[model samples]
Target chain A: MNDVTGMPQTAVVIGGGSDIALATLRLLAKRRLRAVVLLGRSAEALNEAAEQLRGAGVEEVTTEIFDVNDFSHASEVAEETVARLGTVDLVLVAAGFLGDASLEVIDPESVAHMIATNFTGPAAAMTAFSQRLLRQGFGRIVVLSSVAGVRVRRSNFVYGSAKAGLDGFAQGLDDALVKTGLSVMIVRPGFVHSKMTLGLKAAPMSTTPEAVAGAIVKGLESGASVVWAPSSLMWVFGILVHLPRRLWRLVPG
Target chain B: MIPGDTDAFVGWGNNNATRAVHRRPRNTKEIAALLEGSSMCIARGLGRAYGDAAQCAGGTVIDCTGLSEILAFDGSSGVVRVEAGCSLDQLSRYSVSRGWFVPVTPGTAFVTIGGAVAADVHGKNHHREGSIAGYIEELCLVTPDGPRIVGPDRDPELFWATCGGMGLTGVITEVALRLMPIATSYLSVDTDRARDLDACMEMLASGDERYRYSVAWIDAGTRGRALGRAVITRGDHARVEALAGTQRSIPLTYNPVQRLSVPFTPPVSMVNALTLPVFNSLWYHRAPKHRTDEIQTMSAFFYPLDMLRDWNRLYGPRGFTQYQMVVPFGQEHVVRYTIERLQEASCPSTLGVLKRFGAGDPAPLSFPMPGWTLALDIPLGSPSLAVALDDCDRHVAGAGGRVYLAKDGRMRPELMREMYPRIDQFLETCHRTDPDGLFVSDLSRRIGLTPTTPTQRKGMKP
Candidate 1:
């Protein structure tokens, strides 16, 4: 359960191997977070992240195999996680696929995989987790969306469209759970220098994984439904989202 | 069955509000029916609990206020058998004029008898007398197993569990409470101002046994030499000879009035960093250095905060958390450390109360012990507030103390066993009577007192 300050004591990260998710868990561990369950496709990466969290003062760390592309077992995975932990105070959805926009636009197979990883799979997993959280009567779900979803850019339209779907879905999920003990928080980082964005051109107001993790923790404490990393991106995207199509296209990626 | 009114219910702190179906049972049968119909529920009094002890999210909240009826009152024996919904205010008004008073009361008279029992409330005189649990002769608990009349001798395990059980044992339908006899409705109070933490503790430790009731109002905002400056007040019920009046007429008159009320919650807390230090300084300076035998009304001496209705709104819409913990008698340093930590963190506490507690009752979850307790009402806006309070929790638990469950909205579940060593026994008793854990509240869930699995009725969907 979350403590008096609304900081979660027990957390489950779906994309356990994700750099941003691990960073956020580390920060939460420093704030007295006791236990964590890391779920990801790679057993090696999940074990590494779990060891790091243990060293960060988390008393208990467990790893489970989870695949974003395996949509059939989403509900089962969520149920298993809850059954194993007894009570999960927070669930972090940080799985994403930043496929090559130029190549994925032409390759149907890659586009399908990217869409499933970024949108369909995560939405299914969150939906399943939300049911378990509702049964438990109290928990928070934080999904990592991106600024690219604010206005789907032509530069990475395939990835941006998938993020847009996820961003909208998370916002709606938050509203649907109103008055229930469950809440959904959406974190939109402008651009983070992590494994997923390695070698990619740094966007304006780009941030580090640690900075985004800090924002996520702050967002959880403040009970904000949507959090923008670097904070300035909220205003930056606010204006850019409304710009003319011709000017928007001319804006740098 | 009568339909319940669905609404949002918050504790007196006005934070952590949750939606629940509120059923006001007019009689025991109705209460039993409501309990039977709901998968999870808890009894609620006037909602005076500072936290979520009374609220059950996504479940039924049995509003016991409507079941208020004084069934029997023995004037000579001072034993009253009243329905659980009867408030201390109502009972005091009826009994005080008859030369009797409720044995124990919290900081307010608005609390229901049921709540007083559930929280095992202690008063200013706790160092001399124990909590309300000691005054309770018997309880008519309506659990899933049915109504059972339990007392100290009859089903002692269930009896002790029901007391200070946070309504988890069952809905307290009725309580047979032993009222204390009184000569008058007023008290003869002695006030003293202490310069620092050491002086205040010395004064209270040395003088508390001489008086029936004693408490200290601490100035937590002050630092350095002035740190923990306090106003210590000790009193006993004023006798007829002590009442300075015209022929001693109407000596037992007991009419308490609300002089002021906060009408609405402000956008920000009125008791914040800017105003807290000033209030504490003025409150400290306003106290008399040494005054003896000053006649005061019962309300003025005990329930002063009750004078202003909804005073919690002074903390604004964010509400406040009352961090009340008791360290054993020898561990006075924990009390000082707590106050110092709050001051260092800049978490302005509007009201700080320091009291000496006597031996605890048999109830496993009961909060009081032979210790010095400090309760601070801190507004919830400070960013560092959570970490600071967490630090206090560790220190209190380390020193063999525990936070009051009724007043706690946010406490770490892992520390529950460490603070309350008898928690496993308490849970065992609860499960024996309520196998499905029907009586559950947000506080129970937050503190890990309830069963781990989500409760589901036989035919109910999860």
Candidate 2:
């Protein structure tokens, strides 16, 4: 049994250990996805997470130590992971960094790190997987973007700007695969309280990781190309994107 | 805390909310691990026990819904082995197409197999078919020690104890159930209106034997003689030959679609003094005074509430409690007195269901007995409601009657003892199977099933 809707039974979670990724994996598991591969940095952490997903009833969860920072061999890793998991039905890109927003003026390296982690690395990895999905003639790729990317603000410009690049990349990639039997879902969430955002003060309309996972699942089931975490944020960002620069700068971090 | 993983759980009543660690474990191993990890733990299925029967405060709640699976089904023998998390809805959807149906189903098919076994739920057909426990052939229980397959003849005490033990004996991982073969999905129903409490009870008692399923919708709107006036509906599965035309083409159609929904909790309850009387009267007068052989869809006859999704939200933010009690055969007057009491107290009930129960199960905590069972869905916002229910409890206890634990949110521990005389036996079985006292829930602690420590439990009304 592959989900209540009888969708594909296999999936691969590229960025594992993050709260939203785990939450997304759980949703897929609930649909009785036959197999899932958690590709991440730490073996022990991935092993524990694999046990957790297995306990939650996923038939097979294979963990591999693959870092997103190792962007040179992104396609090689994707192929290996998909081969190990049997078939890659869906690929969820949730690996990103929300670097120090206050230090962008003092540090150029920190800003570049943010861009590499949030934009360049994931775009490259998803590109490799997208080619595989098209070759196979049917698959889904869900890229976790952010509302911060919708309209970058001075409060967190370094992180927000990086997400902006990733957001544009995801949308363009989605359009590129329109008729290739492969689909790309760009998920733009408002502030999500996951492990990455642990100590940060909550923002308005902040949603939970589970809520994001639920949205992603709904997106996958409905074949929606673009999905907003709280959905209402779609309209909220719609106005924010067109805000006058003077007013946008006045908004708080 | 993982926001979605850990949540404050409330029963179907949505009252007495408690903060508990909730984990939806997907397999039997996960269930076992959870039990082993948490000293104070309980298994929850669908969270449909109306109250805290499936919840534990400041403890781990292993949500068994993840383990839902229809392992195997034998068409010839009508035997099925399913994970405890399998909902009656899922089972019915699958089995009905194969010319089989769950032997017993509650008012709603949303309940799970484990929950059905744990509560030993009885349907309208209780007068004929007993509780869900009777149809169980065997069960796989995951205890702190490990999983064990217990059956009636193999481990009768553990099996019986686990049946109505409210998930206290252990977490029921899987169940091998005996399904009932049906010729068609439609029911040949008969509807009748009774003038008063006496007429309702008398009609149910006399005519119930002729039908496989029987239940009445009683009106608590009118006081005095008309207080318990009701519309009774009884039915049996329509045989294949009973189908007229298009129905014959698909004798086993198990499609239940939700056409409407109460999207969010309303600021005020939809059921009030102004609405209750009008709705009840409309419902009462709508029934044919005496209609028979009316072919009704199985979903319409068994689960009408399911068609309107989240109808519970209509009770408003405060939610409501479904107080279901069963009194012995000769003490049927208690039902009338309770109805009159509610009316006098000015406590309006949205809906009241009355059914005849025949014989008790071997499980000590099982609710049914050979007598009258009346269930009232009362909004919790009414201050007088709780007091009136207490009075009803005392009246029921005085007559050796008991309340269904599954539908209870707030019945006193002392009253529980009075209602279930063999509670000690159930506790003894719990101790024997789980000597460490690993399985416990808010319902168990609130009702003194486990040693009550005020610190372990919170949100109990004095």
- Mark the regions of model 2 whose C-alpha exceeds 4 Å error after superposition: A1-253, B1-5, B454-462
**Model 1 alpha-carbon miss at residue A216, Å:** 2.4
Model 2 pairs whose backbones collide: A3-A31, A56-B26, A57-B26
Q: Give chain A TM for each model in order.
A: 0.97, 0.94
DockQ of 2: 0.01
Question: What lDDT would candidate 1 get against the real structure?
Answer: 0.87
Model-by-model DockQ, in order: 0.25, 0.01
Q: Write the per-residue lDDT of candidate 2 for residues A58-145, one digit (tens) a residue.
A: 8778888877778888889877875665346678898887767785353877778878888898898898887654433346788989
How do the candidates score on chain B by TM-score? 0.97, 0.96
Q: Which residues of candidate 1, in runs, are more than 4 Å off?
A: A29-88, A102-136, A151-169, A172-176, A231-251, B1-8, B19-21, B34-38, B244-248, B454-462
User: Each candidate's lDDT (Cα)?
Assistant: 0.87, 0.81
What is the per-residue lDDT of model 1 for residues B1-462, given as tens digits with 9 covering 90 to 100? Answer: 112356677788887666678789998888888878988899999999888898876678899999899999998899999999999999998999899999888989999999999999999989989999998889899999789999999999999998999998999989999999998888999999999999999999999999999999999999999889999999999889988765268888678889799998998889988998889999998889999999999999989999998899988866888999999988999999999999888898975999999999999999999999999998885667877888999999999999998889777677889998988778878878888779888788667677434623222221
The top-ranked prediction according to lDDT is: 1
Instruction: Evaluate candidate 1 and give its CAPRI docking class based on DockQ.
Output: acceptable
